[model samples]
Target chain A: MVLSERDNHLIAEIQDGLPLSSRPYREIGRRLGLSELQVIERISALQDGGVIKRMGIVVRHHELGYTANAMVVWDVPDDQVDSVGEKLGSQPCVTLCYQRPRKLPEWPYNLFCMIHGRERERVLEHIDSIVASQGLEQLPRKILFSGKRFKQRGAKYR
Target chain B: MDDTDRAIINRLQESFPITDRPYLQAARELGIEEDELIRRLQSMLESKLLSRFGPMYHAERLGGGLSLCAMRVPQHEFERVNEQVNVFPEVAHNYARDHEFNMWFVLATETPERIGSVIREIEQLTGCRVYNMPKEEEFFVGLKLEV
Candidate 1:
């Protein structure tokens, strides 16, 4: 998508995240020499166009007591992946769920879902229930518990 | 955290109004002054309770490509391989995992084709196999870890 000069500038400024102020739009407009309404309008249009996925807070789950995080990968049949992905994604405990291509001989898992909790045991238990209820016991799977976070930040296009 | 702090975290996570006086509106909804709301948010950010507060952009929609890539590095060489992988500007999120595919990261590229080349380059540089797992289908799951 080719963004106009103005829109590009606005995205560059706001990509770090919105300002933490009562009138954040106003502050952003002040910096860009735009009216608060214009800022809001541009953001709304961007979102409507799918350029901006969402406008929300990015919380640190660990600090919020969600220390246990596991990325569960499943090797379900190709035809059934869509249905299985939808079912797993619908689970409240699943933070992320998607379908990825299986790398041939070495790697076979195609469906991926992430679950987060305050404890490792709790996360495991949740995964167990998901596997049982979702009828995924027969599928080959692996649970990779996340270790240290080397880097995590918003995507920077500019 | 106190009730007010918890309230701010809970409310802000779901949605932040897009308005001329967004903070004021949020404060009104939270039953607090605008300045106090902003102050609390700033403090929380400073204390690292919130990693970031802003608009989340969909990279693929914005003419970029993103994928989840993993590597299986020898335990002794994990740190060395990690440094090599992190040096790439496209690497967004990197994490160590306790599996054969020990190192995992997200690569955000300027173009979709760049994903393959990036993986190839990393494989050569790190001397390890790079598994590029680009999402073929995404299910919408509004992930809100309730505090």
Candidate 2:
């Protein structure tokens, strides 16, 4: 979508995250010389255009008692990937799931899902359940848990 | 997935108040009663659409070890390798980014050494090389989906 100067500015401002205030949009509008309604309308338009994804909280799972988190990758057959991925992604425990290209002789997993829990064993149990249910007994998979947390943030589409 | 859900998501994306009664404050800001806000939030949590609604801490300030790692698994062994790698508690979001180094995952650990050890264990289990690419410089990619 064509982003006007004002729209670009608005996107940049909110990209840093909205201020923690009673009237955040108003505050932002004041800075941009636009009314709160105007700001909201612009954001809604951007969202409708698919320029902005979802506006939601970005929590620290570890701090919130989900001490254990892991990324699980699956090698499902090409034809069944969509059905399998949809089921896997819909799970409550699965946080992030998407399809990415596999590099031959290097990377091979086509489907990826992230599962988090309070304990390591709990996370594994969930993964095992998913693998078995999906009838992926023949497909190979791997789980890479975090050894450290360096940085994490929502995307900035300025 | 509808208009109401989109509106609620937009509201949640913005930070909630930091006051003693944050929920009450949020309710006032949203022009809704405290109880209503609480009810909606509970419902949102019940729905997987809202992954979480809470604090986004600065891990570096707290001295946490974080890095992005990738593995090269042969097509035949991807599922097995995925299971072994995910067993670790420290793994966070894993993406199948389109790259030669496929299978990208994030590790948030308490120490840097632990990051190495975890990679080592994955390498042994998957029988593949683990590329530990820790970020030398941080790039902030603010990706918010307009639900």
Candidate 3:
């Protein structure tokens, strides 16, 4: 859906985040010369169109003591990836789960999942449990811990 | 963080009411005054516990292209390559991971076709092969870091 110029402007204005206020939409409307209802309607439409995934708080997991973060990659057979990925993604320990193209001759892992915990051993144990329970222990896997967080933020649209 | 703060973080992470007075609505549900909820949220945000509080847009669904790209740069050339790669506006979240494929970054472009060109540009600038690993399938895990 092609967004209007006004819609783009509204998105750009609130992309960073909404202001902490009782009536945030109303406050935004005041700034953009829109009615509170109009702002709500526009946002609702955007969400309905799948543009906005959800309006909520983005928590910093590290601050919550989830210091050990690792991106676990697995070389699951292409045929079994869908079922295995769904099962893996359903687990609470696995945060982000997806299938990316495996670069042959170098990168062999296609299925990827992220796990975070208070300690490295704990996170590894969680991964081990998932692999064992899901019958994915046979597959080749690797876990890469995030070393330095250079940047972590929502994709900038503007 | 106290019980109320924990409750706020847990509740707000899953859902934030979209209404005329959202904070008021949420506060009523949380059994706290609207002002208190707002104050607590403000404090959490100021503390950087909450990176942001707003709509989370799916860039791909919104006619934008997104990909998880990685590169393996030599230790000495890591910083220079990182700077060169991050100089592009399309580069979103870049991180240094302890692995052979060390440098990872999320690339977001206006068009799906633009993804390839950006990767090419980055490769030319950094003189490093850019592995454009776009996600083929995504499973919704209801990812929520419950504190």
Candidate 4:
């Protein structure tokens, strides 16, 4: 869906966050020269259109002692990736899971699942459980533990 | 964080209502006073427990672009490459991961074409080959971390 000028402005406003107030919409409406109802309806429209993926609390796993995060990638056969991906993604412990193209020779892994935990051993165990439960024990895979966050911020949508 | 806070975190992770009196409505559902809910939410944001609280956009859905680009600069030139790559505002975040392709960062651009242009610019500026890995399929994306 193409975003109107006002929609863009509205997105720019709430993307950071809705004001922490009793009537947050009213405040946002006030800033954008839109009524509270307009703001609510527009946001609903965006959500329906899939422009806004989700609206809620964004948890910081690192702050919550889930520092031992690992990106587990698997080189599953193309034919079985969809089923395997869904299986991996259905697990509660798996935070983010997606399929990306494999850059042959150097990066052979295609399916990626992000698992986070307070302990490194626990994260590994979770992966082990997923592999065993999903019947993916023999797949070629690699665990990439993220280190040193040099930059982090909300996406710039303007 | 106590039980109430934990409960609030878990509840809110599912969703925050979009309504006139959203806080009141949400607090009612969560079985907490609206004022208390607001206070806890504020406190969490301030304490950095919740990095952010709002709409997470889908760039592709918005007619833009998003991609996870990886690179392998020599150990000696990693920092310099990082600086050059990050100079572009399109680079949302960069992470040093344990792999041959060490420097991994996500690019969120205003247009789909910008992704390639930015990749070209980075390759030219840093002289390091960037492995552009856009998602072929998104199996799932639910970032609900129960505190």
Candidate 5:
């Protein structure tokens, strides 16, 4: 989609994510020489057109007492993937669920989901429940947790 | 771009202040009715074009452990492996990148040590090497899509 100069300017400003101020739109409008209403209208349009997915908070799971986090990989059958993935994605604990191409002699997973909890055991327990609920007891699976947080940010729309 | 869309995006890009009745504050600044501002926001969110409307936190400040991980799974077993990797709660985002390590994902943990253990568990269970390609240098690519 073609973007006007003003649209470009506005996208650039909020690319790093919204400003954490009560009058964020006003602040942005002030910098861009636009009114707050104008700013809001532009964002609404962008969102409507699928250019901006959604604006939401990226919670710090650790701070929220979700200490144990892990990437659980599942070896789902090709035919059963769509059904299984849909079911998995519906779970609140499974924050992210998507399919990815696997590398031969390297990677071997197609379906993936994310689970979190305050304790490692609790996280594992949740995983167990997911596996059982999904009838994946016989599936080959693995979990990869985080060792360090190097970087994290909302998608930049510049 | 039409005037209406331009106006909405322009507003979304700004940082909303953290205060009581922030929406009202925004409305006053916009010279529009508070209800109108809220209705617009609600409609945008309902449309699924916008994922969410809220705060974006600096995870590191809260002592969270995060890393980018990759695994090499045979194409024949791609479906199986993908399902296994995604089950973990720590895996925030997973992608099918084009490379020798086709499957890549990001993991965030409350403790750093758990990150290592999680990787180890995946390796043992999957019978594949979990190459931990942790971030050594940070590159901030602020790419915001302008619809």
Candidate 6:
């Protein structure tokens, strides 16, 4: 969606996160030369239009004791990818799931899902349960546990 | 984190009201004082338990692009390549994973076409081939980590 100049400014203002104040939107509007009502209305409209996927506290899983998160990659057949992906995505444990391209002989896994848990054992158990219930035991897969998070932050447009 | 903190995290992760006094409204719902709610949030931020608290914009819908790119950097050259690749503001999140493709990072650009240009620049700067893996499709998953 093409955003207006003012809307772009609004996004830039809140990119870091909303202000911690009684009148957070009012503070934002003051910076953008807009009224509190206008700021709130614009944000509400953007959210209602699905431009804002979510608006709330973004947790750092590791800090909250969810240290183990593995990127589980699956090599599902071409025709069966969508079904498998949908089924995998439906699981509550799979925080993020996507169908990315395989990089030939070096990388042959196309389907990817990220499962997070406080413990490695529980995370693996969850994966095992999913595979058994979904009848995906035959699929070849690899689990790459994340290490050394160099950087993590919300996207910046400005 | 205490019980109160956990409750706040779980509740706030689902939604945060946008209002003249959002904190007050949320505090009432969570059965806590507004000042206490704000205080806990502030402490959490300082302690790094809460990475951020705000809107998550859909960059694609806003004409931006996002891709997960990986490079198999030799162990000796990993540090140099990491600093070089991270200089670009477009590289949002970078991680070292256990795999043949050892380095994985997310690129979020202001424009969709910028994704390719950034990838080209990274490859040139690091002298490593980047496996550009842009998502062809994303399955809908509303549920997130409860904690």
TM-score of each: 0.95, 0.57, 0.95, 0.96, 0.54, 0.96
* TM-score value, chain A, candidate 1: 0.93
Tens digit of lDDT per residue, candidate 1, span A67-146? 78999999989999989999999999898899999998888999999899999999999999998998889999999999
For candidate 5, the TM-score is 0.54
Q: Candidate 1 — which residues are off by over 4 angstroms?
A: none
Write model 2 residue lDDT over B56-113, tens digit each, in one string: 4333432457766777667678667777777777776565533345576777776667
Name the regions of candidate 5 deviating beyond 4 angstroms.
A20-22, A153-157, B1-22, B25-147
What's the candidate order when arranged by decreasing TM-score? 4, 6, 3, 1, 2, 5
> Which numbered prediction scores highest in TM-score against the true structure?
4
TM-scores computed on chain B for all candidates: 0.94, 0.86, 0.93, 0.93, 0.81, 0.94
Write the candidate numbers in order of decreasing DockQ: 4, 3, 1, 6, 2, 5
Task: Write down the C-alpha DockQ for each prediction.
Answer: 0.78, 0.09, 0.78, 0.83, 0.07, 0.77
Q: Tens digit of lDDT per residue, candidate 2, span A1-158?
A: 66688987886677655544446677778999998888877866766665654444654465545667677777778887777777776676776676665655555777767677888899899888877886767878877675544334442233
Of candidate 3 chain B, the 10-residue stretch with the lowest lDDT total is: B138-147
Model 1: per-residue Cα lDDT over B16-45, one tens digit each: 888778888888989999999888888888
For the record, the alpha-carbon RMSD of candidate 4 to the native fold, in angstroms, is 1.3
- Compute the lDDT of residue B75 as modeled in candidate 2: 66
DockQ of model 2 vs. true complex = 0.09
Instruction: Give interface RMSD, per candidate.
Output: 1.4, 11.4, 1.3, 1.1, 12.8, 1.5
Ranking by lDDT: 6, 4, 3, 1, 2, 5
**Candidate 2 CAPRI classification by DockQ:** incorrect
The reply for model 2, stretches above 4 Å from the true place, is B1-147
- Candidate with the larger TM-score of 1 and 6: 6
lDDT by residue (tens digit), candidate 5, B1-147: 235433554565445534434667766777777677766665554553454465333334334566667777788887777777777777766766445556777777766677898888777767777776554322222212222
lDDT of 2: 0.64
Q: Name the TM-score of candidate 2.
A: 0.57
Comparison by DockQ, 3 against 5, better one: 3
Q: Which stretches of candidate 4 lie over 4 Å from their true place?
A: none
* B20-104: candidate 6 lDDT, tens digit per residue: 7889999999999999998999999999999888888888888889999999999999999999988989989999999988999
After superposing candidate 6, which stretches have Cα over 4 Å from the reference?
A: none
lDDT for each residue of candidate 4 in A1-158, tens digit (9 for 90 to 100): 88899999999888889899999989999999999999999999999898988789987777888888898999999998999899989999888888999999888889998898899898898888888888899899999998988888888887
